[model samples]
Target: MQGKAGNAYLINELVRLVYLTYHVQDAGYGDTDVVVYARAEAALERCLQRAEREQVWRLEPDDAPMFEAILRQAGRQPA
Candidate 1:
């Protein structure tokens, strides 16, 4: 999984996978950017909430820069 995000292209692939599997439509990559934006934001928020509740960084720094990077790759900014 770490290797899967070593570069920009890989990150794009990861996002594409998420968008496709979860049916997250693309903005410029499709007809409507608004729909994709809403769905993708919802998906990302769910993931973040889950991570927080699960204490996903117990043994780590808790900064979660990795997840942040993933968000950046998906064309989303961190909160």
Candidate 2:
């Protein structure tokens, strides 16, 4: 079994992960970025998966960064 977080908690974490990934990308930590971003994406996916499994809620655009915002935050470069 996996640990679970409330919807509010998940959103907060999602925001953090989004920023953390951008930070890591800019830092150019090589395989370290892979390790971290994989975990971050997995966390996002797992949150949605759990929500679906429990029939509680689904992923909402309101919870995601806008494309412009993501670009701004992540910078205009590949990871």
Candidate 3:
């Protein structure tokens, strides 16, 4: 993976896991689950930070709308 491609991959994977993690939980998650989602959001944020620093490719046009779409699909908001 080179610059943009690498960054895009990281973002894509993080978003996928974030969405998956939320959906796999019970209909009503407890405090622990909140912690879990928080961690996932944090991880996504970290990757996004790297993407900015590394000049990663765009998440929209060129690739999937990993950030907004994934969160929306999971009824989550970026924190």
Q: State the C-alpha lDDT per candidate.
A: 0.41, 0.51, 0.52
lDDT of 3 at 16: 72
Writing each residue's lDDT as its tens digit, candidate 1 over 1-79 gives 2312233354345456455533433323323334444555454454445446763312123324444444444554221
> Any runs in candidate 2 off by more than 4 Å, and if so which?
1-5, 12-16, 27-32, 56-79
The lowest-lDDT stretch of 10 consecutive residues in candidate 3 is 58-67
Which clashing pairs does model 1 show?
Answer: none
Best by TM-score: 3
Please tell me which model should have the higher lDDT, number 2 or number 3: 3
The digit string of per-residue lDDT tens for model 2 on 11-35 reads: 5566574666567666773233344
Superposing all C-alpha atoms, what RMSD in Å does each candidate have to the true structure?
11.7, 10.0, 9.4
- Relative to the true structure, candidate 1 reaches a TM of 0.32
User: For each candidate, what TM-score against the reference?
Assistant: 0.32, 0.39, 0.44
Per-residue lDDT tens digits of candidate 3, residues 11-42? 67766766664654444432234555665576
Judging by lDDT against the true structure, name the best candidate: 3
